[model samples]
Target: MAFIPLSVPNMAEKEQEYVLDAVSTGWVSSVGPYVERFEKGIASYINTPNAVACQSGTAGLHLSLIALGAEAGDLIMVPTLTFIAAVNPVRYISADPVFLDCDDSLCIDPKKLRSFCEECCYIKDGALFHKDTDRRIPVLVVVHVFGNMADMPEILKIAEEFHFKVLEDATEALGTKYLEGPLNGCMAGTMGHLGVYSFNGNKIITTGGGGMVVSQNAELLQKIKYLSTQAKNDELYFIHHEIGYNYRMTNVQAAIGVAQLERLETFIATKKENYKLYKELLEDIPNISIMPVVEGVRSNYWMYSVCFENSKVRDDAIKELDKDKIQTRPVWGLIHEQNPYINNITHNLEKANFYGSRILNIPCSSGLTIDDVKTVSASMHKLQL
Candidate 1:
């Protein structure tokens, strides 16, 4: 009977137990057992060899780029349709992002990606370079948009040919997996050179505000851990060999994370079931379509979205839904169009802009009951009349 909020954290687990333990033992800051336990636990879950805890997903991304040798004047390929945070790390490294478009799955388009690498870029001295700018494109930031996997096999093949590192932005796709192809059974984040996950309050699992950087490369992960903790060669002596950051995730947050990770599978199942119910409820609505998970991927259904015919229809639904105490929101605007990134070069963004105006994200928080879905669906159906 009350307004349904969009994507709130689910905390019916050992969150209290873990956080209380951390507080009672004076391990609430960035030091203590929970941080290492949380990092190791996440690495085990995702099948990566290592994981480093960090302050936020953006920090994880920045550290990953730095560890992987991102330099000034470098070009990193990113999807224009993704959240702005995914591209901001490129700027953090003094590198620029070349905006690529998304396909129907709302992830980076593999075909366009190939075309850009082969037709638009020229190879020299074993590096891929943009013909016009001559800047080396060494990394591709592929986001698993809304828990759906991009065409990673195709994307990986292209990356191998062009020699670019793949950094997966798995902040919204932690539980997703590829069910088919060369990467069959590979988790979304584990497939890339380095993958980053967010445990913000809105994620399937929450550490209040924290992130993890995972990789099969143990050495790379160690460097990230070093950088995350101020790059101290000797903690007792306070000797710093290189520039680092205070991006470590607090022990209290990691304690919460360890608890949250315990219930991740159940949360993912709830999300899948809720998404199915929404699909069934909204199927008959006119001039609207649901964004589907890709064919070979098992998505976590992190955020359920609907595409309307136009912005007017979407805005009308938002107004009607809110009036009925159901909160709904439009998808983020195209990142390239933002004020800070307006002048950046964007490849064929036809679909990005098309979905930008038409897509709406509906309530699908982990704790959402079937009754809540029914109420939200009924309110949304009213807009079709």
Candidate 2:
């Protein structure tokens, strides 16, 4: 059998057709019809008033911060359990990040967030300010980890009480949504003040490398679009009033994104079905269990994670899987632990520390077959002996 891979792009549909169309039309740069098409498709899917296409998820996040008026001395709240991209944008604006812990859902813990605000921060002139640094804590970046919806309602409540903004990093949760409660029918990205999605090769869908930003505020979305395209005050005379970035998504990428958007639901369905199959196959096995998505949410199930009894067991499983030609990996190192962020202040990260070592992500690509899943499970079962 061929080597099974980790998550990868499922380009079995109209990807080639759209790419060729984009190439033939000579509108392969940022300015093209396909870009608008992709933006509209995403806005419609997310039920947002507007969306702006950007070079990557990181770029979308950076643009979101700038549009939200994040400044050099501002403080942004983020989860330590998330990818570094989610935290890097805070530094991009010269703002410091106050890392927070994650709950069982592997999303930011609202309790800790609220506690930090109430215990370590104070309200001044209707804005939240950290007591130690006196920096205004203006935004909270929430990541819906592994397609699992974060505890948004609770987090939103905290943000409201603290007078801070919410930025949803739905890069890994494009199709995830709430199934019930006050946020019923709300998709991951649309619930926050601003949200971003990625179309990287390994994501559920792909545009090679691209991202989209959505917001309820159409005016902000327009400003983000202008900022993404160099913020030209006068296009004809090449006059620019403010600093901007060349972060616009190219037409070729947008073309691919438009095609990928056509089949997102299909891709998510495959992911869920495969996740179910893996759970069933490994249910009776000891020493490991499939991590469950939090209740009241329908996750895209982009990555299938297995939690081992301990870090040693998880590492052994990873090595054994590699020898069996099945790719696997551990969860990301906590952002607060990373070298660049070693000095950043962090709230209680007890749960983040607990799961960081024992969790291993198995292959869960949309293109993976039943036989592949069975092989992975059967191989993992052998490790018990």
Candidate 3:
């Protein structure tokens, strides 16, 4: 039997038409109409003043840090349970990442974050510096894990007190929104000083591989765009005033993104419907629990994640799912324990460590039909017997 993949992009016929037009126009390189249109569409969708498209989510993070002046020896706070790409950008800038724990929602725990910052940092020369590393903690990369919104209100308040720049990683949360408070109805990427989105193949939408950085600050957005395009000065050719990166997305990719963006709302709706079906079907299972949307937040349900009682049960379920030709994956390893960041400082990761082992991602592609969901649920139900 063929395996049902965990995730797949939903590319309608319109997406193919856009790419074909771009190819026929011979504007398949980095500079083209599709790139501009995609940037504007993304900025408009997220309600941001401007957006800068880049080659990948990692590149977008790197550019955001560079624009915010995150540098060597600066400490950045990141969640321990996120994908490595979210944390690896800190290393790209030669900055140290201090991993924070997650809450029941699998998002960064604001309580632990504040406590850690308060205990580990002190004001020196009017700047916040870590007590042990003596490095300035300049930025906080808050990830919206698996399309669920983090506690932005509390996190933003802490960022204000500590004077750290906030970079919202909405890479997995394209259509997620907070439903209450100051950020009421605001999209995930719009709540921070700067935000990034991913358009990778497995995301809600795809540009084959592309990302965007958005911010209300026009100057910062311009700087990010400039840095992404190798910091080229319009007045002078090959003029180098600053170190930059070649991270601009090709026009071919942006063409696909433009078409994909057009269908984002439809895809989000499909994902939510599938999630509801899964929840209804799995509600009676004792050892299985589906992730919940916070009372005041709306998730895109980018990946429908389920948690078993423990790692042993989760492992058994994985094997069973595979035997039935259904694809499933475990959550990311705790970033603090990873080889690259093992030496970094970490706060209490009790929840993150626990969830990391027990959690498994099921098939959540926008293309999954109602029958596919029923099939998956039936397979899972059989596991209980």
Tell me, by lDDT, which candidate is best: 2
What C-alpha lDDT, on a 0 to 100 scale, does residue 2 get in candidate 3?
56
* Pairs of residues at least 3 apart in sequence or in different chains that clash in candidate 1: none
Colliding residue pairs in candidate 3: none
lDDT of 3 by residue, 51-133 (tens): 99999999999999988989988999999999999999998889999999999889999999899888988876656789987
> Which parts of model 1 are misplaced by more than 4 Å?
none
Name the lDDT of candidate 2.
Answer: 0.91
RMSD of 3: 1.1
Residue lDDT tens for model 2, 1-385? 6799999888854878888898998999998999999999999998887789999999999999988878998989999998899999999999999999988888988889888999999999999999998889989999999999999889888888889999999999999999999999899999888999999899988899989999999888988989998999999999999999999999999998899899999989988999999999999988888999989889999999898899999999999989899999899998999999999998877999999998999999999999999999988988852
- List the global CA lDDT of all models: 0.91, 0.91, 0.90
Least accurate 10 contiguous residues by lDDT in model 3? 231-240
Regions of model 3 farther than 4 Å from truth: none
Tens-digit per-residue lDDT, 1-385, candidate 1: 6979988988864899889999999998998999999988998998888799999999999999999888989999999998899999999989999999889989999988998888789889988899989899989999998888899898889989988899999999999998888999999889888999999899888999999999999999999999998999999999999999999999999999999999989999998999999999999988887888889888989999999999998998888888888888788888999898998877877888888899999998989999999998888788863
